[model samples]
Target: MAISGGRIVIAFVNVIGLALLSCVADGAIQLAGRKHSLHIVRRPRGRNLAGGDPTVFNVMNFGAKTDDKTDNHGPFAQAWNAACQNIGPAKLVIPPGTYMAGQLYFQGPCKGSNPIIVEIQGTIKGTTDISEFQDDGWITFEYLDGLILTGGGTLDGQGAFAWKHNDCRKNINCQHLPKSLKIHRVNNSVIHDIKSVNPLGFHMFVTMSSNITVHHLDISAPADSPNTDGIHVSGSSFVDISHSKIGTGDDCISVGQGSTKVSISNILCGPGHGISVGSLGRTKGEGPVNGVLVKDCTLSQTTNGVRIKTFSKSTPNQASGIVFQDIVMDKVQNPILIDQNYGTSRKKAGKASSQSKVKISDVLYRNIRGSTNTSAAVSLSCSSVFPCERVELVDIDLVYDGTGSTKIVQNPTLSALCMNVKVKPGEHGLIVMEAKVSLGTL
Candidate 1:
């Protein structure tokens, strides 16, 4: 009877364990089903059930081929036309597969009470033949307000062949290559969850737009590819770029002239020139770039980190109310740079002049700590004639890490070069006196 009781207890315990396991399995299945349902529900609806109408136009229904070789420009245009004409909120869907396309433009003040959504779930492969594109972008959306461009797909710019033909660096008259994506004069828009790779020129260009938000993007290209800026913003205001990873050859984020009230945060930049405010003042009669903020950024293995560059002999301009704070740099070349003589003429004058026409003032660099690969961790080559004023640096701690044989040893002990600028104590009253190295010999 004792052996029978023990056997009965063991059987009971096994049954309980099996029941627990079954319950766990059932819970997992239910969770997975809920997740799937959420995804389906989040997807753009084909029919407006509440309004009793169908407004979603799938590109495949208009004859877009999924085989990846056929050009889908015609079908895409057809679908765009139908969706743009829809009276209510409409969606243009590109289903999952590779679709080769040429230069396509979507121009709108789309006929809708609500914003139009372009949902891409597949790859849009750009044609390698550069002649097929007449403008500077492979795909462009122009004059569109209240647009929503969200996708989990890729925009592949086959730029390797065209990169060889690019001669913009050597010749000033070089033809401009096409950008992967360009949004011109578009306002109140959102671009999220997209991957842009290997563009012939810039990965994405935003110009003449306002109130734009770009987030959750993965932009990349080979480090050696020239002129492939991850994101270039010009003549735009009230723009925000956050939570993006950008690695490319040129500036990860280039804020051009006439850009104001811009905010950049939570960005990861590497294998490129880090976030740059200007290359401003290169042209005459340019407007002021003001009220820009770059914070909480990580730049690793980049050429420069947190830079503000302006031209010397250009028209008078002002770059003011700029802030760079809470940045982490890992082995960057120039961790902090404020060059007022950015693109000086190659013809050297008999006398050295530090006069820059650009008025760079009210710039702040705070809580910047990093290891710089160069000895001069902080370089401020401001203009002598129109000197930079009210430039403040607080809690900046950068170390030189170049100790190998191949490293250039010119001024290896130099920590900072402040030419002609006014340094003020920050809000925390933290300033580095030793970093104020006067380079009078330059």
Candidate 2:
């Protein structure tokens, strides 16, 4: 079920919010016209496990002190080793306390027969000092399957001081600071009920993984923190993210190239860049993105709301079957956008200045309503080289909040911009233009 060819049609007029249920059960999501279930990932049962009740391996037992100064890296590693190697089914617990941890790596492919649970009840604080991270990330859960990471605790990256060195916004060659949490090459995992706050870079990076469901997460950082994306998913598939409150400096949730069948719903995003699908197609041989559904989300005070951005002068690729529906914008800047001219200006693009090569197609924005702070609430600045095809905006009702700028346009509500994209007759709403798309007011 690689949802390619841009034929996926999933929509609902009214949506019901569903809580994250147990890991083994199929969580059926109720929608107005469709019922799509989040099939939680689970591997087959066999065993190196010691057939018994699950054992609890506490970090304190492995010489982890509950102080705020001593680095608990060794103790945490030892506990993960004991739990992954010694048990049929084990619970790795870090009890309630303030802990200073530097580069906590929970690498997996455990010998256990059953699922492994890493329950963190205390706060694990990261260093403001940049020399501590030898790897590219702080806390990494790599090469694991059937993991449950919960416990409502915080992975605090204490990034207020470290953000000064994060010059990726100004310097393109800046070495990125470590992300707070990285889930890489993992499968069949449920990460929920956690709070990840103030990372040096992205709060969570889910990359090269599949069959994962992430929900009930509260991720936040300063709105001005540079490059601090809340959750970034790249090169992954069959993922579901819902019921999260995310506010950060960068994208609250970003789906990059090679990602497919990603379902995002019930999110609260503000004080950051809104949920995005790109800034991609930079390098040659880059993969295409397809089968994305973003619905039932709310964006407030964000830079851009529900956008698909491809880099300028990009390589050849295609992005299709992307849907954004039932979204609410609360004083957002750009409530609906499709920018095919994104770039970092450290270096100039040379292929052609007029257009990009990435072909974007089959996008749907339906039932989106709210107020935007910007006068032009919608902008579809597609590429002139490849252009955009089969884009639709239906039932959109957005108005200017009258507080973004002092200089007001005569008709703010109908001030959407479109170029190099086509909306078929009887398949569009609001603004209508053949060559340059402008719409009627909501």
The candidate maximizing lDDT is 2
- RMSD in Å for candidate 2, one decimal? 9.8
Q: Report lDDT (Cα) of residue 309, candidate 2.
A: 90
Candidate 2 vs. true structure, TM-score: 0.83
- Point out where model 1 deviates above 4 Å: 1-54, 345-355, 403-414, 423-442
Task: Compare the candidates by TM-score and give the number of the best one.
Answer: 2
Q: What is the lDDT for 166 in model 1?
A: 82
Q: Give the clashing residue pairs of candidate 1, or none.
A: 354-384, 355-385
Candidate 2 per-residue lDDT, tens place, 233-312, comes to: 98898888999999999999999988888889999998899999987887778788888889999998898999999888
TM-score of each: 0.81, 0.83
- Model 1, 201-233: lDDT tens digits are 999999999888899999999888888999999
Could you tell me the lDDT of residue 425 within candidate 2?
Answer: 30
Instruction: Give the residue spans of candidate 2 off by over 4 A.
Output: 1-52, 344-351, 403-414, 423-442
How big is the positional error of residue 363 in model 1, measured in Å on the Cα after superposition?
Answer: 0.3
